[model samples]
Target chain A: MSAPDLADLIENLRRFADDRDWGRFHTPKNLAMALTGEVGELVAELQWLTPRESAAVMDDPEAGARVRAEIGDVMIYLTRLADVLGVDLIQAAQEKLADAALRYPAP
Target chain B: MSAPDLADLIENLRRFADDRDWGRFHTPKNLAMALTGEVGELVAELQWLTPRESAAVMDDPEAGARVRAEIGDVMIYLTRLADVLGVDLIQAAQEKLADAALRYPAP
Candidate 1:
């Protein structure tokens, strides 16, 4: 099946917040902070794993599911922050990549 | 300026990895683990902030820049992981939202 479009996801998130009267709480600053918190939680999941063990996390079905959900959390908050700030997530990412290409060009 | 397109970001990351011969180290599992580590770093930036304080992190220019960069790191790893696994990050995010809408419907 095809993947969902970023625009649609943003719209859905917008509606979700609006419906819950959450927009007032979703200012760019608030969302950014929330995004970091979610990222922290995601990291907490692997806090004690050795690099090799961390790398093998998905080998465990339960751990894998939790990891995916945390990823989903990160993405959700990220999208919300971008949307609130009028930043196009995709475009910003592309620009960052362009910058990276210059900073770390092919040998 | 328009934000980056997710697909383009993935392509750039793929090229970055191929150029550095980093693909051998970027399996989905490895990427997932690395993603978590980056998230950890992102979290460390705000570990001491109360929720109210956390919500205002971007008020400090230096702190804001650091936060944004960490976010960029998170996005880069996320894009790479999705690319490696043939998952469409945007689409998967949309699907996750669709599920969330049901799980946390409007009141």
Candidate 2:
């Protein structure tokens, strides 16, 4: 896909969901609960794995899909959540970048 | 302790660290490095736990202290990082709560 207007990316995602008649299924509580569920799934992906294993969990063919899919699911829900709440995630992200720069100033 | 002004709560945490002359130890990169370490520990708290087991991981005395302490460490470092970067974590939190309310409007 052409680079989504970064500014309107969340809006675009919401519109895509709307086009599919999925907005009804995206009630805030449902979205939040879904977000939480995705987090759990992400956690589960690394569970029982040693640190080295956990980091490389993304490289495994079988488990990699599960972990990557869960991350994308979380992002999708987060985008929609931010959209419904009128949060410009990009702006928040940009602000955070600036803040991080200050906090992580080069030595 | 007197209720910390919600606005300056992060600042207060920074002050607490400063009082102990720990600022030198809280360089942003170090704090971020430390934050990631805490996240690893937090994950470790629930690693290999069944869903039920994960939810109650905090109930185990031995593991509970570790989980709680790591969470507290994460929070402390976060507060300090925000302060040094001129971010008002309380404000960010408040904004997030407002966003959540919008996303999760009661049925």
Candidate 3:
């Protein structure tokens, strides 16, 4: 299967929300909060691991699954928020990268 | 220009970090922490706004720009973390969404 893109995820999320009558709960503020919660979950997965251990997290099947799930949750909420706000995720990211180039120039 | 995909962002981020000699700092823990920080910033943008107000936030150019930038930062860090961990982000998200569908069935 072809890799899913941001637009595809947004569409799937919209349908998921629609199916569950979740639109009312998907406001920008709420989505942002959900995104935060997901990111926290993701961080908790690696919080106590040493850098080397953290890098090797995916070597363990169970822990790797949990970490992957959390990453998915974070992206789902983030993409949902951008969708509600009419922000193009890729465009926003591209612009931010461009802006960062100036702020942190290569030595 | 054509829309940028997740791989493109990952490649660009890799180059960005490489150019600035910042890979040493892009550990899974560090990237996850950065993701949390960016999510915090995104949440702060909507923290005090009412539902209706939060929905209308993007109507204000200044607030919209900040919100967009925060979203960008969140994605950038997230993509970076996933990359460092050697996780396929699109696959992770797809699997999680599939799992969530089973958990949150339509009524």
- lDDT of candidate 2 over A1-107, digit per residue (tens): 33333234455565566655777666444554565565556556655776555545545778755554544454555556545544444334334434544675534
**Could you tell me how far off, in angstroms, the CA of residue B70 lies in candidate 3 after the best superposition?**
0.5
Give lDDT tens digits, candidate 3, residues A1-107.
46676667888889999999999998898888888788889889999999888988999999998998899888888888989999988778878999999988888
C-alpha lDDT (0 to 100) for residue B75 of candidate 1: 79
The digit string of per-residue lDDT tens for model 1 on A1-107 reads 25566777888898889998988887555665677676667667777777667667777888767666767777898888766645556655665667777887788
**How much is the lDDT of residue B15 in candidate 3?**
98
Better of 1 and 3 by DockQ: 3
**lDDT by residue (tens digit), candidate 3, B1-107:** 36777778999999999998999998898889888888888889999999889999999999999999999988889888889988877777777888999998989
Positional deviation of B54 in candidate 2, in angstroms? 28
User: Residue A32: error of model 3 in Å?
Assistant: 0.8
Q: Give candidate 1 misplaced runs (Cα > 4 Å).
A: B1-4, B24-73, B84-87
Tell me how candidate 2 scores on lDDT.
0.51
lDDT of 2 by residue, B15-82 (tens): 55566566766654454455455445545655566655544554577875554454444444444544
The TM-scores of chain A alone, one per candidate, are 0.94, 0.73, 0.94
Off by over 4 Å in 3: none
Lowest summed lDDT window (length 10), candidate 1 chain A: A85-94
Write candidate 1's Cα lDDT for B1-107 as tens digits: 25556666777788888998888898655676677776667668777776566566677888867666666777788778766655566656666677888888899
